[model samples]
Target: MRQSEAIACLREKGYKQATLVLLFAAIDQLAWVAGDKETVGNEGFKAWVQQYMVEKNPELLSGATAADLWGARCGVLHTGVAESNDFRKGYARRILYASNYGQVGSNDPTVLTLSLEWLGSAFAAAIVWFLSDLEADPEKDTRAREKLSRMLVDQQP
Candidate 1:
């Protein structure tokens, strides 16, 4: 299924955590698929992370920053814990959102620090921007179509 369709389904159902996880996974998966799948916790994935965060965190993406975010990703996917010490330490506990910290715990540059709402917005915005890019580049559009088709359809005969 298209990432846009998945985003729409999440928005329609108001699936906050699901949306965050799905989009984060999508960005991470692209990095691995196009970069190196074995570089999850290593410095080798830093470039991919930087590229992925360019849409929202461009001015702040770096090796250290990517590692911090990867820690969060690891906590969720590998450990089933959503706690990132780097993230927790990076952000202040006092940042308020309607008298609370909001869906995300912090807004610190050292951390990914994105709220559920922010994730939805970023995902939607990135999709739009990327689609526009594809429209302008037929090669990219064709490659994406082929890749997506290979993913969604069984090729065994």
Candidate 2:
């Protein structure tokens, strides 16, 4: 819930890269929750994002594969850059971000550009959609609830 609050605040403040880092991390965390797994490896992250984020926000995440997003997430979160081993190894595309109501585009075929605001909004919408889908699937909902119940809480003395 704190992550959700932080993301909401970052999105409101228009911190492009910071917002993206949290967003990607949120997806990773949710993937584990949804699957009732203790941990989500790289493949799990890709699969979850592919099934949830990419499918729900195809228009916003167009031209960027789940692998590409994973690479971007690693780069942004680990190195504070936009290039990762996945990109360097030709397994994923490099991604650049734009802010201030910019459009998503790319000058090179291997490098995709996306709008920060749009990506944030798309991710938010995708969460809503994912939760709705989870509601219809009793098994997944039960798994999600179990995982969510174990999440860390911010307790005050």
Candidate 3:
């Protein structure tokens, strides 16, 4: 999809933090690919996501930090390593829940409203990053960087 259309769809989806995170992951993966061809296919894109996560978090799940868990989820989803399921059972739901939350109640308002708020802010920052055209205009990109930096610095708990 086109960038504007994709962003509009995201906005329509209530801008859920998880979806934003995935979009950023896709953008990051696309950025690192040397050419457009390398990024246009599912297999290459999946490998890019996995490599990005590995570069960011070499340990994968065994020794992954909280930040690493987010990358790992993107890697797992982008990779169609396994498929098929049983009606009586549910593996996808289990993976989905695990990928989206670090701890139980971590994303829910009732358990920790602050976390949800912070997640929204993080996703907003990611949106800015995903949308930036850094190569075409460095000055504009720098301003965007400063804006995001200020947003993050102000958000410190």
Tens digits of per-residue lDDT for model 2, 28-73: 8888887756879788788888887788787777567889999999
lDDT score, candidate 1, position 36: 24
The reply for model 1, stretches above 4 Å from the true place, is 5-15, 29-49, 52-67, 84-112, 153-157
Relative to the true structure, candidate 1 reaches a TM of: 0.54
Candidate of highest TM-score: 2
Q: What TM-score do all the candidates reach, one by one? A: 0.54, 0.89, 0.29
lDDT of 3: 0.38
Q: Please write out the lDDT profile of model 3 over residues 1-157, one tens digit for every residue.
A: 3443554466456664545455545444443332234233434443443444334433222222233333333443454322223111322221222223233344422121112233333434433544544556767566545544433122223
lDDT of 1 at 123: 44
| Residue 100 accuracy (lDDT) in model 3 | 37
Model 3 TM-score (2 dp) = 0.29
Q: Which model is ahead, 2 or 3, in terms of TM-score?
A: 2
Model 1: per-residue Cα lDDT over 27-63, one tens digit each: 6654443432344444434455545454454432222
